[model samples]
Target: MAETLSNLFQQFLLYMQSGGFVMWPLLVLTIILWYAIGYRFHTLKRGSKKSVRVLIRKYLTGKRQKTKGLIDRAIVDAIEAVNGKCDGKRGREIIEDLFFPYYQDLKRYRKVISTIVMVAPLIGLLGTVIGMIETFDSLASMALFTQGGGIAAGISQALFTTQLGLVVAVPGLIMGRMLDNKANMMELELEQIKDILCAEKGLDNEI
Candidate 1:
């Protein structure tokens, strides 16, 4: 498997080299974008397992007779202790205050991902233009006016850059989109819990 992987990487390098200098930077950017996407995905996945629900339940159901203990537990549990206690508005307000920063961070992650997605194609196009220019220049210099040939080589380089760009963008875009959706879902869940808490406190009529 290692040998096969190494061979594949060697082949990819050869292909990239064949595409010419314009493709090099675009390829590098794609690699960086992929790394960022993978990093964020893994980090979020790990954090998601913190069991926010269980902590909330424990805090809510714990004995309230000990006033000091109750407050201490509430403080300790913080967002994790979200029991359905406040009115809808108050609950949402509390939750919003607590999670706004986190939600914004998640949003920022998606923005970075999307920026890479958009930039990759444009970079590829630049590479294509560069490749075409080089090809034309080569033909002019070589005095190949009779054949109307040797055009394919340049075109192949152009296509190669575009193909690599899309290959990088597609998966990054898909994963970024999925990540956004998951973040939204998590936000909504937080909101829903807040709503439930607020309803318990008679704050939100809808709740």
Candidate 2:
């Protein structure tokens, strides 16, 4: 098992070397991108399978159970904000104030993910261009035939960076879109929760 792991590590090192210095930046970008993606996923999860109204009702009845997911926490806070006192516009404003952090949380790391997705491809393209330049320079100096792998090696490096860039970007784009959709849905649910709380004339009775 140790031998197998060693071989895998050796192969990974070789792969990184082939992609040249740009591989380091790409690797860093990949790390940051996925971290952001993971954070968004964690933040956006709906923890409970229950509908927003059901969760709100559960809390309003003084159940006050432990919460999970962004919406679940928001609902609990909203209930506490009113505490069977304020209602209508006043209650909504308070709820909104309470919810502001959640909205910000939903937005966290979204821009970082987006920026990395956009930049990864361009960075890869830059590597490709650099590789091509090196290859042509070798050819101009009549070293192409003398060099170990010559044009083929340089071309491989160029294409490898491009491939790695696309690999990093495509998934980030897809995941980013999915997370964005989830965030939007959660936002709407939050709005619905607010409206429900404010409109309920018998909120105190319910509690």
Candidate 3:
């Protein structure tokens, strides 16, 4: 086990050395993006699992009237504003007005995630280009006798950049897709919540 660990560490060290300085920043950005994706995932997961229906029912029926937090306050305001605009008619219009933005917000929550995922790969590509440039420059002044060594050094370093980019990009893309799905699922739930609320209020009387 220790031998395997040592071998992995040695390989990582070689990769870093071949990637040169630009790869370091890419590495840091990758770590930051990973943590951000994780954080967003946890937040979206919790958002999905939250009981918006019960909360709304409790507030609307007067079983729970206290404004406990920002989310609750938002819900109350939405319900009140919607109910008022509804002119106490208990129509679907009020429910639509109140929860459309909730659905929109769920969709928007993953917007930054896409940007982060896209940028990670581009950054990795940029690092690869920089590494290749350095490798070429080092090769230019080498003695003819050592031309093969120079070419090998340049090729190895060039490949390092590509590898680094993939290392960052692949995971970022995977996580981004996962988070996107979560956000989409949450939006679907919000829509369901909207439908339920509208029905409970008799707003769908037109249907």
Candidate 4:
């Protein structure tokens, strides 16, 4: 395992060297993109197979069992807000207020993930262009013919950035889309929670 890891690290270093300066920015973008993706994934996780109404019903019955996921926590909090000492606010307003943070959490890092996904491919293309320019410049100076593999190596190295950029982008794009969909679904579920809780007189009524 140690040997395999060392070999992988060596290959990664070589990949960075072959891609030139653009690889650095791509690497940073990859880190930020995945971080944002992971955060959004954690934030949007439902942590339960139960439906929104079922979870709400459970909370309404004062079942204070352990909570999981955004909705679960929000449901528990909303129930507390409604059942707690009245503070001159309607149950609906209180529930909405309680759910506001979860709403923001759902939206967080979404734009950052999307921006990285879109920019990664463009950055890769820039690297490719830069590489091609360098390759041609070397050729112009008769430096290409003196190299072991000459033009082929230059071209290969030039394309590496493009490949890296695409590698960074495609997965981010797919995961970002999935996260966005999950966020939307969670948003709707939050709204439903608000509605279901608000419709109950004291949250003691059945859904």
Candidate 5:
């Protein structure tokens, strides 16, 4: 088993080396994208809950000891405001001020994912162009069809880099889009929280 794995690793290195310098950047991008995806998934999953609306409603009424998330904390703040005990805002307004920006903070890494998606394909194209130039240079002396070295290596590098780039990009794009959708869904839920709280406290009048 160890030997088999070692052989596979060696083969992977050979392929990367063949793909030339572009492979390094592509690999780096792939790593960064995957890391971002993992972080997004972890954060969203940890933060998500079922029947959050109900939990929020209960908290707003009187059960306000345990704060589950931003919504609950907002509820606590809102209650303080209604009693005129808070710093100067209603409970709902307190929730709104903190949560509105908190949502924006949640969306931070998403743009990075988007940027990587747009850049990967261009990097692949760059690799393809370099490979083509190398191949053409080999063809200058009618050696492209005859030479087994530069001409063949250039074409191989071209194909390998292009393929690697697409391979890196496709999954990153898909994952980025999926994470974006999740973020949107979370925003919608947060909006509902705001609406419910505001209705309970007449927050527009408070502010």
Candidate 6:
């Protein structure tokens, strides 16, 4: 498996070289894109074993101050808000205020990932433009074309970069969306936990 993986990387490097200078930027973006994806996956995977509701209940009923992970932090905030018979609506607001920051934090790099997804193809297209210019320059010496048609080589390089751009982008975009969806689910779960805490804290159910 290691040998196969090494061979694949070698092949990819060859292709990148064929793509020219634009490939370097695309390469950088691709690296960032995958790094962001991997970070989100690792974060979500190593998240709380228990649900937000369970964590909230435990925190409220018991005495645990410090917390780790996204959901746990939100639950801690909500639990801390349970100041002896507080107004329900106000308690919910407090939870919301605390929860929103962490919710945003959980989705760290959401915009960065999206920007990379959108920009990668454009960069590839830029490569295509550059390739065309190079091809056109080569053609200026039209006398050489008849003897050794290098146009095919130019065209191949142009298309390869454009193709690679889309190839990198499609997966990144899809994975970004999936991560966004998961983040939305987590938001909903945190909200539910907030609601439960609010109910226990005060009489008004408006929150």
Provide the TM-score for each candidate, comma-separated: 0.66, 0.89, 0.60, 0.87, 0.79, 0.74
Ranked candidates, highest lDDT first: 2, 4, 6, 5, 3, 1
Model 1: residue 150 alpha-carbon error in angstroms:
7.2
List the lowest-lDDT window of 10 residues for candidate 4: 198-207
lDDT of each: 0.62, 0.85, 0.64, 0.81, 0.73, 0.75
In model 6, state the lDDT of residue 33.
92
User: In model 1, what are the clashing residue pairs, if there are any?
Assistant: 86-198, 87-198, 88-198
All predictions: root-mean-square deviation over Cα? 7.3, 3.6, 6.4, 3.7, 3.7, 4.6
Q: Which residue pairs in candidate 5 collide?
A: 77-91, 78-91
The stretch of ten residues in a row with the least summed lDDT in candidate 1 is 63-72
Ranking by TM-score: 2, 4, 5, 6, 1, 3
> Which stretch of 10 consecutive residues in model 2 shows the poorest summed lDDT?
198-207
Taking the tens digit of each residue's C-alpha lDDT, what string does model 4 give over 32-87?
99999989987887867899899878777767777777788888887777778434
Structure candidate 4, residue pairs in collision? none
Q: How large an RMSD does model 1 have?
A: 7.3
- The digit string of per-residue lDDT tens for model 2 on 96-173 reads 788999999989999999999999999999989988887887787767643435676678779999999999999999
lDDT of 3 by residue, 1-207 (tens): 999999999998877776666677777877777777776665554322247787778768876555653345545765676567664455566666666665555555365656656676676667566655555665676532243335555566567767777777777788788877866766665565556666666656663
Off by over 4 Å in 4: 1-5, 87-89, 145-153, 202-207
Question: How far is 71's C-alpha from truth in model 3 (Å)?
Answer: 13
lDDT by residue (tens digit), candidate 5, 1-207: 999999999998988877788988999998988888887776554232646577666665766566555444544554555556323245555666657665865597888888888898889889888888888888886675544347887898799889988988899888888888877877776677667656665564443
Say which candidate scores most in lDDT: 2
lDDT winner between candidates 4 and 6:
4
Model 5 reaches what TM-score against the true structure? 0.79
45-164, model 6: which lDDT tens digit per residue?
A: 425678766676677778575565667766665676666534644666666776777676668888889999999999999888877776776788663342223565567668988998
